[model samples]
Target: MEQPVHHFSELFEQLGLASDAEAIEAFIQRHAPLPESVALHEASFWSPSQAELLRNALEDDADWAEVVDHLDASLRKP
Candidate 1:
């Protein structure tokens, strides 16, 4: 079985964000509970490049998609 190469820290790095565990957790906490009406890529907090990366990852189902989905879930209401 193949292990996924993408992870939350790496995703943050790709987004040009702080990639440490504490930073990631804080970021998630800060922006969490995102409304069901919003798509992850459409979130206003991201920069243009970050949004584009997220959009492409999901739209193309790129290698980053799995972790991207994880992040999206983390930010939204359970």
Candidate 2:
């Protein structure tokens, strides 16, 4: 079975996403595995507001820079 995701918000926080619409969406898309289209049909089943926020992030480039910086730091771990 797929690993249990206790809370979707955890996904955002783990990715260091800002609590903005675009960032949430990007987080979802980035983490969601292939063959699963990132759509509210699946996402909406959870929380509409959160899902919408994620969708908006997917559409906008709002949090790209910060996320990248965070990623660079994470990658340097020994």
Candidate 3:
């Protein structure tokens, strides 16, 4: 069976960011429209540990990967 996916709120909480709906939206608004050359894990706004968590989740396809991908997509919008 596939693992259940989580919400962006949970992903934000895991990243040690504010996890409320408003905060999540604010975060996306602030950092989104990522450059094509920069991957989510390579974004300059993340702390080292936060970046590592995202990198690992994507690399390992962890339970968090789905939500992480959602975040990645959100950031890519122009």
Which is the leading candidate under TM-score?
Answer: 3
**Winner of 1 and 3 under lDDT:** 3
Alpha carbon lDDT at 51, candidate 3: 99
Model 3: runs farther than 4 Å from truth? none
Q: Tens digit of lDDT per residue, candidate 1, span 1-78?
A: 764688789999999999999999899999998999999998999999999999999999788999999999999954
lDDT of 2 by residue, 1-78 (tens): 543423434445644446466775664455443233434323433466545554554457334434433432332333
- The clash count of every prediction, one per candidate, is 0, 2, 0
Most accurate candidate by lDDT = 3
- Cα lDDT, all candidates: 0.92, 0.44, 0.94
When 2 and 3 are scored with TM-score, the better candidate is 3
Please estimate how well model 2 matches the true structure, expressed as its whole-model Cα lDDT.
0.44
Residue 70, candidate 1: C-alpha displacement in angstroms: 0.3
- Models 1 onward score TM values of 0.91, 0.31, 0.93
lDDT of 3 at 68: 92
| Predicted structure 3, TM vs. truth | 0.93
Candidate 3 lDDT, 1-78, residue by residue in tens:
969868889999999999999999899999989998998999999999999999999999899998999999999997
